[model samples]
Target: MSENDTPTTVSESSETKDRPVLKLNCFLPYQLSHLAETVSRSFSKIYAEKYGIGIPEWRVIATLGEYEVVTARDVSSSTSMHKTKVSRAVAALEKRGFVARDKNPDDMREQTLRLTETGIAVYEDIIPKALAYSEGLQAALTPGQQELLNEIFNRLHQAARERDIE
Candidate 1:
């Protein structure tokens, strides 16, 4: 038989073509997600180990530090966390002496959360370190790339919000 007429080689007992192929790694997105999770977890771990606060607790403290006083619902909205989660975190922070909850004088049923002096000191001590770590993370990317990433993430956030994922 001529070269073009020769029988094609195939997998033994199978009809599939015996050719090299490219296969996408479906775990690529998962791998990226895992990395992101690890980075955040590591940040939390460092903050907790050095400052004695959990991740959610740190967020609560940070927000309360900046706002001085805000409702638990507001913290939930700002953090994109659930109301129950914020409530629980606030309770934990209050138990730790890092947060103070006071019934709003104007509305007896409404309570505002604020960081205690100790919480402010802890937040102040960690903010610079957290920012430095953030800056280090972006050191490999150009300013343009960082901006583009932020835009893409914003769009994703909007889509999630529209879909009621929040």
Candidate 2:
């Protein structure tokens, strides 16, 4: 084609016409992420407002409360949170007197974390409220639906793990 003669190719309008439009509302990953965020934010309000702890801090507290003594690496692995996030949360909790750390007898570099008395009290106070919130959410579904949901979630979890292996 000569420089003077402009060439006509597939226009932007025609190219866009062939592309599939994504509906985020119906997209599985997007829907799952949105639902998880919504639930976490809603539940977090209970701890955030009452205890002044954010989600990461709450996760650390809950983990320590359950395990009694675990390292920061354990918390990160269990909660799937980054090591930096767990460390920061641990620092905040320690500052608030909610967590205590002790050097491991066998490993000087590793420290085990545990909940302080105050942390235990906060955990005790939040447990009932967390159960109530969970029950409230489950109440929206029938018993059969709840059972089916459990099964569906288990299957999805397994599928994700299997996919990871592949």
Candidate 3:
């Protein structure tokens, strides 16, 4: 939202004795959440239509592509997805022969996941497309704006990490 835009002032609620004046449009968390969802949905079309996979599955594939071998728990941590979602995506990928899971030697109860040859080929094909898409988005900004955006993202992420509940 731009500074010139007027925000709806929310000052009261039915059950609240003391409610802070709130402006949803200008709220940082709300704006960030909306932006993230919009970007993810828009970007998902590229992989969704081509691979018939949703956000969770694509996240798993990307994580595996980067790390080569990881557990569902590891993917969950890296992708910030719930374990259940990662588990289901891993299962779908395994069924499609894009991923292989084996019992971890270090802990037999744990499963280790890796991409198969087919998975690697698909990932290789997608990498260039992903890079091109990222470049397309970056094209909208000047080099200085791009650097500033990256810096802002890093700072915000660090702040969020520091604010984690645990």
Candidate 4:
């Protein structure tokens, strides 16, 4: 029989017909990634326009703001950013006089990073704006929905951790 005239059989067509299709719009991972990118870009406009800092720089500044002192490795771990990205961000922050690095006396190769006074000032200025932005986003959801989303996120985090351990 010609290919086009061949009778369709379950075995012959099953590979293509039965295979589940992935819809990017409905995919959880894609949805999450798109949401994250959108939110990050929106928030980035705040600091980028006002303070001339990008997401990486903001992550470094925020991490240092909280930890007070840390290594580039620590910032990478905390921000889930690549070490190279963290290094570049640290260098940029230092150049901007928003971050200071001190060599570890015990380990000359290691450096502790901290926010400078100017960095602290920037952090202080940006925090309220961040909070307001976050609050505005949360305001779109009802309190119950917000609580449910928080719980869902916590569970997802735990599941991811477990999967990573495996």
Candidate 5:
């Protein structure tokens, strides 16, 4: 194909436009959630690349690490993931020898999840790396700025939960 016959990409058009064909600015309060999603995607990709586990699996393992044993519903609630997603993650982790499921004594129908010894070792290895990543992320921010940002995020999250669809 001739050079002039090739189609131009949207980003190239964006740069050459007189008034920015696309406004590209985020005006809604939920826009920050998009940024958070981007950050989570990047972190998950990096962590998965390093450790060979996906984000949902990581979330399940991490949550189980914090609490010795938790129900599938509890995992879903804590991660804000759907029940099916949590179930799939639990299944994957179980296959990888990281998690074990047992009958919940209190509720015979529900299952409780726990990390295996290998899973605990994996969590111990990843926690420091995760902390270092977070520290590196906040390295450029002043302590006050960090605190303010945390407060803002918490307030926004609370508001979103209050407005959530039933």
Candidate 6:
């Protein structure tokens, strides 16, 4: 793909004009999204089947694993998941006794979620596997390429954020 001519347009016909042609393989956004989903699914297998949790649950667990405590809204924002998905995942986790909800005294309607002892154990078990999977992916790139890729990813991420605000 030409970096300068992404989604390169075809001719504007004298007859019926066709829309611009975007090759999915060459489209940056599509490529990134596809890779991310593919990687997530692949990684989910490590935790999903053994732990009986899916993507949304895994995300919530990981967040709670990191922050120790957070609201459903916080999980939604952090994981870029919709609030409904977060709600459902939280419900599932709560039912499984992997998560506990502590009622907010100030706002009875709101609750903060924390991992149960079971959840922490799962998180701890998953960490080494997660790190190994990450290391395997990084092993595909040389040190220089990995560094460059990190910089490129950060730039694109920042650009997307700016565009989102606009």
Best candidate, TM-score-wise? 6
What TM value does model 3 have?
0.85
Q: For each predicted model, how many residue pairs clash, with residues at least 3 apart or on different chains?
A: 0, 0, 0, 0, 0, 0
Candidate 1 ranges beyond 4 A from true positions? 1-36
Model 6 lDDT, residue 92, Cα? 98
TM-score of 1: 0.75
lDDT of 2 by residue, 39-135 (tens): 9999999999988999999999989988999999999999989999999999999999999999988799999999999999999999899989999
Superposed Cα deviation of residue 103, candidate 1 (Å): 1.5
Model 3 Cα lDDT, one tens digit per residue, 23-126: 66678998888788877898888888888888888888899999999888999999989899999999999998999998989899999999999899878988
lDDT of 1 by residue, 63-83 (tens): 887789899988998887789
User: In candidate 2, which residue ranges exceed 4 Å CA deviation?
Assistant: 1-17
Arranged by TM-score, best first: 6, 3, 4, 2, 5, 1
Ranked by lDDT, top first = 6, 2, 4, 3, 5, 1
For model 5 the local lDDT of residue 74 reads: 98
Candidate 1 overall Cα lDDT vs. reference?
0.79
Which segments of candidate 6 are over 4 A away from where they belong? 1-17
Candidate 6 lDDT over 1-166, as tens digits, reads: 5534544335535323445555677788988998899899999999998999999999999999999989999999999999999999999999999999998777799999999999999999998999999999999999999999999999998999988953
lDDT of each: 0.79, 0.90, 0.87, 0.90, 0.84, 0.91
Model 3: CA > 4 A from native: 1-18
Residue range 24-76, candidate 5, lDDT tens digits: 33445545666667678877865687668888999998999999899989999
Instruction: Record all residue pairs in model 3 with backbone atoms less than 3 Å apart, i.e. clashing.
Output: none
TM-score against truth, every candidate: 0.75, 0.85, 0.85, 0.85, 0.80, 0.86
Off by over 4 Å in 4: 1-18
Badly placed stretches (over 4 Å) of model 5 are 1-25
Best by lDDT, which number?
A: 6
What C-alpha lDDT, on a 0 to 100 scale, does residue 53 get in candidate 3? 84
For model 5, what is the error of residue 109's alpha carbon versus the real structure, in angstroms, after optimal superposition? 0.5
Quote the positional error of residue 85 for candidate 3 in Å. Answer: 1.1
lDDT of 4 by residue, 1-166 (tens): 6323435555765656878655456677777788888899999998998888899999999999899999999999988999999999999999999999999777899999999999999999999999999999999999999999999999987887888953
